[model samples]
Target: MTAQHAAAGQLQLNYWAEARLQRWGHIAVPLSSTRVAIHGGYGRDGKKLRRLDDVVIVSSDGTVAPTVSSTPRPKARERHGAAAVEGGFVIHGGRAGGAFGDAWRWHDDVWRELRCEGSPPAPRWSHAFVALPGDACLVCGGRGDAGDLDDDAYVLDPATQTWSRVAAPAFPVAFACSTSDGQTIAFGGGRAARFADAAWSELALDDATAAASRRLAACVCATARPGELVVAGGVPADEGEVGGVAVLRIGEDVKCVAEAPLDVMRAYPVHAAAAFSGDGVVVFGGGVPCLSFAPVFGDSVRVVMT
Candidate 1:
């Protein structure tokens, strides 16, 4: 475990006591400017594998603790999409017993299942979701229940409490990382039909960038600045298992710069990343070394200082 401080070019990583069980496919949504709420994941309690329904609150002030929500909790799920909405956080489709189409809203320290209007997307897992402007959220490609990959997209409006399908992506991928800068949303590498591929896709635009060629699957992405994004911790296409981090600068020409390796080899560490106030990104729990069937778990919290 290392403390928080700046290195010459390397990002600073601070390790703390494990707040919750080491798990993957969990969602972390920012509750406040300095605090984030972490939701469900697949993990083992002792010897049995279980889908967790735990909620842990992580604060930038170095406080990590669990929150006890009111009764009538949502079903334990993993690979779900969570986005901060008007008054609270909205959690959408994920795999519980199977792929789930239900959506839940968390507000005032309580969870309420939402009955939305319009046709919702099919049940899926490991999809990419980004909070859009005007209290809306966009959900993209993932793997369906029948083991088929999805190319469809959907939008959820909080104001109207409705859902609507949107334009599909050229390449349908799952476990990809995505980040939005209000104008455009960029996604990186993910599994297509069989093997993982090096590909990049964008929403609302067709302009491809040079940084799009790097293959990164199951990684976490966050906006480091207004026009720049930081992608960290995932398995690369060429690499056997482990992966590193990179900074994507978006402008007239998008390029990845200031690449660095993480302290430990990790893939699919955090389902969603929380941005630091200054210049860093926080990575929560994820699988380490490799994504094997009986995977080894990682419990440390990593921060990439840009």
Candidate 2:
């Protein structure tokens, strides 16, 4: 594990590690204090892309294990979104041959397809799905069927299995990452998402450094401290699409953490999965070698406070 000095907010990058046979565009969410569950991704090891037919659980000790679901789960998918909720993780909208509009939940050792009463969000991939307070969920912006980015948002009430349009402006991005503290949510990719109001009300900018970042693509992020997030690994707009490990702050100003970026011991880590565990943020699984279509294996990188 390579170590770096702490600078920005006094939080140091603990070390870099390898990732597990996950492929590109999979969904990942925290399962426990030291482990995260990764599901559904595709690979093009040769030429044609296909779904990876399995679920993987990654532990902080750098161990990767196959998850044996006692109940049947959804078919292999890619570029979908998953959020940790009260009982289990809720997954929604992604693609294999084409984009999907279905939603499912993993609970009680079972997988159940969620049938929305009315028209749910249109078929999409890489949208942001997050758990909200009261166990509700918010769905927003993603690449839609017509190959256009969506500009709408909706909230799902788990109790009623109903969808309500959020009375606020939607996130202007797709393929971004989002996390919530049951009160505030932080999201973004090419741009930063708001995280302050418990209602996810329109956010007020910190006027700090959220304005300093260039639009990034395929970036992953996790909420760290309250009102703070740790963002890493994205392709900058003008950088010829090469992935890098630059650390970015989304909510408040760029404060703690080292000034240097964190990188993987293996893959280039674009389109990776991220979740906060203990004092550190764990980044794992993605298109290895960056733009190249390769699978991730072994240990995953962890960025922790010193």
Model 1 Cα lDDT, one tens digit per residue, 217-284: 44445554665565655555556544455665555545565555555542244343444432356666
Clashing pairs in 1: 269-286
Q: State how far residue 75 of model 1 sits from its true place (Å).
A: 0.6
Candidate 1 residue-wise lDDT at 22 = 66
What is the lDDT for 266 in model 2? Answer: 52
* The candidate that achieves the highest lDDT relative to the unseen native structure: 1
Give the Cα lDDT of each candidate.
0.62, 0.59
Worst 10-residue lDDT window for candidate 2 reads 206-215
RMSD of 2: 4.2
lDDT of 1: 0.62
TM-scores, each model vs. reference: 0.80, 0.78
